[model samples]
Target: MKINWAEDLRERVHDLAESLGNLFVEGFHYLALFAIGGITAWASVMAFLGMVEKGHISVDDILLLFIYLELGAMVGIYFKTNHMPVRFLIYVAITALTRLLISDVSHHNGPGMGVIYVSAAILLLALSILVVRYASSQFPSEVSAKPRTRRHLVIAQNRAEGDPGES
Candidate 1:
């Protein structure tokens, strides 16, 4: 058979372009991870310094440290497995709400609208954790050992909620 050199060249160029695109995306991912890690480290150090200036650690300081630690862990997990769970984010948010609530009670004149908002945020984060757990169990990506898609989880959740057209 006569060779189609032009078609072969085009296919090779396409594959090379795809590979370069993937490489660039992966490189950007790692760069982001490193940037996050560095920023978290800096924030943790600054928190520690602030605590020192205050002569000791307070509840708010501790909570802030925990938030920073959670952020670092989130980035680390994403770098390692690329399976960063939403639960980590929810946990961070709950901790932050707790911190805010504490700050509001201590620093404000009295109980104000901030308390209500933070309390509601904590409740919402808790509910989100529950929803995430249910989704993981009902449509387990780990147990099935198959390539699961976000569409699967959303469709399943919508079906269960009687909102078939949600997606």
Candidate 2:
């Protein structure tokens, strides 16, 4: 038997490099998630404190907090599952647009065409959310699906025992 030292060494080197690269990428992902989570938490707390200091909480303040809550939830989900939830983003956008509309109405004497435009945008976002949810339910991603059990061991055992039709 002939042993190829250079080929074996190359394969080992390739595996090591691949492992290091994966490790670095995973580490960066974790670090970035932690930073994002921390910043979101800090900002949320600051906003809450500011509202408290003002001694009055408005609908806008509550909506802002809800936005922060959604962001925090999004970050946590991404950190755990490594998948982004598009619905959460849509929810945030809807809340933000509502806030903008309310702000505009309260500041101005009357609602303008801008209110209609914002409302339309919110409606579109809502429809997109429904479509996304329906599509996800109809055709789930393979990566998100539960892993199927392997039958290789049972098949191999059946073959070794000379059992016909077991496999």
Candidate 3:
């Protein structure tokens, strides 16, 4: 059997192009993550310096640091698992809202419309996080917690294995 030169060349070029594209995408992903890590570190350091200069750690400072911490954790999670969990974003939102509410109530003479709105936002974020957790446990598209994602997937597909939805 004679190998077709044109077909062989076409297949080789296609494979090379695909591999090059993958390498470029991976490189860009790492570059973005590196920038994010650097920015997060810089912000954390600035916040720490501010706290030190003030000689007292306030709720606002603590909340800012928490947001920075969550951002760093998010970047790390993406770098490690290649999946960004929505729960972390919700957590950050809740923290930021709480920080806003604290600042508004403390700085103002009384609670205003902003306080009510921020409180509502925070409550909604908390509820969202709970709903996501429940859904993840119940529906379980992937076995992600403890047992293993593959096992969870199998369990979800097999009813005799004790379905989470049934229980």
Winner by TM-score: 2
On the 0 to 100 scale, the lDDT of residue 156 in model 2 is 69
Where model 1 places Cα greater than 4 Å from the true spot, the runs are 1-3, 142-167
Task: State the displacement of the C-alpha of residue 77, model 2, in Å, after optimal TM-score superposition.
Answer: 0.6
What is the C-alpha local distance difference test score of candidate 2?
0.87
Worst 10 residues of 3 by lDDT: 143-152
Give the top-scoring candidate (lDDT). Answer: 2
Instruction: Tell me each candidate's TM-score.
Output: 0.78, 0.82, 0.78
lDDT of 3 at 130: 93
Alpha-carbon deviation at 156 in model 3, angstroms:
29
Against the unseen true structure, what C-alpha lDDT does each candidate score?
0.85, 0.87, 0.84
lDDT of 3 by residue, 1-167 (tens): 25698876876687677667878988999999999999999989998998999999989999999999999999999999777789999999999888888888888869778888888888888999999999988997763544333333555777765555422
lDDT-based ranking = 2, 1, 3
Better of 2 and 3 by TM-score: 2
Model 1: weakest 10-residue lDDT segment is: 142-151
Q: Write the per-residue lDDT of candidate 2 for residues 1-167, one digit (tens) a residue.
A: 14688866776687677667878988999999999999999999999999999999999999999999999999999987888999999999999999998888888969789999999999999999999999999999868353222344456677888875444
Candidate 2 ranges with C-alpha deviation above 4 Å: 1-3, 144-167
